[model samples]
Target chain A: MMRQEAMGVLARANLEELRGALGAWPEPPDAESLRGPEAGLIMLRGRAGGGGAPFNLGEATVARATVRLSSGEVGFSCVLGRDLEKARLAALFDALWQREAEVVDMHLLTLVRERLAGQIERTAEETAATRVNFFTMIRGEDE
Target chain B: MYVAVKGGERAIRNAHRLLADKRRGPRNLPDITLEQIASQLALSVDRIMAEGSLYDRDLAALAMKQARGDLIEAIFLVRAYRTTAPRFGFSEPIDTSKMSIERRVSATFKDLPGGQLLGSTFDYTHRLLDPTLQGAEIEQAARADVTDEDRPMPRVTDLLAHEELIEGDGEAEEGAEVGDLTREPLSFPAERDLRLQTLARGDEGFLLGLGYSTQRGYSRTHPFVGEIRVGMVEVEIEIPELGFTVSIGEIQVTECQMVTQFQGSAKAPPQFTRGYGLVFGQGERKAMAMSLVDRALRAREFGEDVVAPAQDEEFVLSHSDNVQSTGFVEHLKLPHYVDFQAELDLVRRMRREYEDRTADEGKEAAE
Candidate 1:
């Protein structure tokens, strides 16, 4: 379950950072060669503000892939778009993480967290720029 | 009382041949190409695609040709063809907020973040027919002031949202189930998803009339068009094995957002409510009409009384398909002589009985 959560975070990480982390790993897993990548779409759902009932927002295309290692452990990765290489790499990393948790956790997991944090920060800044506040003035009759 | 009519197969075949000849129209004239229809009569193609619930421009053009330019028939042809297509998968929800806009306008606000772009609209044009367009070779004239920029435009609703004047998009729970009206039969009171799906493919004329009825005090809700945007958005599909997503293709779409005043309720404060419409191509009028109908249909959900035909979900959705309507209306041409003969017999017997009664009354009066 912990590994699965880690894999989800990894899946959502920046594409470039995920790719780079996968490259630096020693004896990179060949799990992608065993299983091909698959790409498709998933309908995105939204909720009303302040945790209201969910509604269908629209459809978003997503690519996902799963790979099984020689050991019983299976790794899965999914992300938004048709990027097959990114999906394959993420799946391979997921598989590797299960088999060699110590190395994968030390190297790939840290990078994923940093990239995610950076992304959140960037979004926050952009949204902050568009923020506006309105105030009404009191009239003489309002004494 | 009626013999069964038959042996019209040969006549039917000849009639079909004649129809083909008529559709072709004078061999000396140049045939209308699919490209011409797709490009020149783009709005028609767009309507067919939108109502047909298919997105292929080429296929829509072909259906238009096969339908002899009958838009509803073209829609039907495209819809029939769509049944044979394999379901690849549902696309990720397009972020209309990020659309590279061609045209963006709002009736509510005069000045907006994306200053109104009245791109390629007939809003200002006179309705006079141009004789010059009749069999004339069209030449492209270069405009000196054309400046193309791919800039992201902010949504007008979002601007209202900042001031807390408009209701925010309700928070959805993670992994919320969305209804697919195409696969599952539509049941009411429907979720907004199902309602939207039905309206997206509903007959534009029917929706337009319903929308107009609402405006004419049937269910008056003072609506302001928050925004009408036409643009292209990238489509991306996830590759699971690759653990990432990539762009598949882009499609042109028209999206409309309508804002209307809502009364304060115990559950929430008074705020501007929204009705949304998104269609396959540059369908501004259809989108606007769809938004109006969408708003009307939400009356029940908003705890407002449903007093109009547009507010009735079954009335609007069940009768909105032109193909179904046309089939039903045209079915009157089919022979119903046997049924009519039974009524005829009953009428004649009733008339004879009345005559006898009148004669008996006359004899009684004479005696």
Candidate 2:
């Protein structure tokens, strides 16, 4: 589960950040082609009122690629739009994390967590000014 | 007797040449570029994207250019282009509550938590043609008091739901698979997912007529527009290897929610039922009509007698595609000489027989 979460962060990470992180790692293991870095549409499903029954919202384009290491560990990467290189890099990172978790966990996972934390903080700050508060006052007429 | 028509290929080639010449129109006037269609004729592109079930604005514009600005034909072209594209992983459901709203309105309430923003709308615009716009220089107007506050707008339906006035939507079974209309043939008693999918890509005019039929007492639901929102929402996709979903991109969509009053049943209390409509782009009218039709089609689920044409799922879904309808209707212009010749021969023989009988009757009367 930890490895999976780390991979997810890696897959969604900024292209430059991901590339920079991967640049520090040692040579990657030989990966066999399992699936393509092909682009296609996926139907998005949503609840009626955010917590209701699931219904299809719409479709969005995505690019996905999968690679299997010689050690039998499989890595999959799916990203938005037609970024084949980004998908390949993500898949490779997934395989590396699976095979060398101790090394990747120590170096790459920490960076990913930091990046995500920064992103959440940035979004919160951006939206902080828009927060509205409503209240009611007690009236003496009621008494 | 009918002769076999020949040289159809040569005739078709010449017709194409003539159409090309006509499209150029003397080669003196400036040719309309794809960028103009993308920006100026943007609504047509949006419609094509909505009906075509594809969201690429540039591709939609290209399709409009290729189809010579015919919206339906452009939609057909986009749909054809989408057929060969591969399937990537499915995105996580969009949270409309977190939508960056450009337009939001509610007919049920006078004022709501998030005040209605009119945004860019033609609701107040006069329908008169402006001749000055033909060669007008466009400039962006600066608006006063632009707020930079980004927050998720609360839905009006939630307020009613808080009071238990509206029927609560039942929870879906976890990990249950959704039906894909593109992969499978549509069958009777379709699921809500398939129904919505069909309606999203359905011809707008057809849906409008069906929706109008409901309002004219066919299957009246006493609907009130709960909310109509047009905005952008971030799309996220689950990466199995990563064990979580990631934001892929943002897309513009129009969503409509219709609240209708339903009387108390043997099993349940009186509550407001919900009808939903969502389209690819900023297509408010299409979304509104779709919601009405969607509500009417739910007659069977609500245990009401299905006495209206709009209430019949098979009828509505089967005939909603304009591409299929146009092809079948326009195919009448194709070669049918043999069939017409046979009908002609039979009619001629019958006429001759009738004339002979009339002549015999006249002679008998004279004798």
Over 4 Å off in model 2, which ranges?
A1-36, A46-51, A56-60, A65-143, B1-7, B24-26, B141-150, B350-367
DockQ of each: 0.09, 0.23
What TM-score does the A-chain of candidate 2 achieve?
0.81
Scored by DockQ, the top model is 2
Minimal lDDT window, size 10, model 1 chain B: B141-150
| Overall local distance difference test of candidate 2 | 0.76
Residue clash pairs of candidate 2: A4-B242, A8-B242
Task: Give per-residue CA lDDT, model 1, range A34-139, as digits (tens).
Answer: 5557755454432222124533433433456677766656766666545777777777777887788877777777767776667444433333333223335689
Candidate 2 lDDT by residue in tens digits, B1-367: 3345687798899989887777667688888888988888877888998888877787888888877778888888988877888766567777778887777778777667766666667776898889999879987532333344434677777767778788765577788777777888899999777788788888999999998898889988888899888877777777665566766556778888888867687878788887878887789889888989888888888888999999999999999988788878877777788989899999999999999999999999999
Per-model B-chain TM-score? 0.91, 0.90
- Reference-based TM-score, model 1: 0.70
lDDT of 1 by residue, B17-95 (tens): 9989988999999999999999999999999888887776877899999889999989889777656543446555666
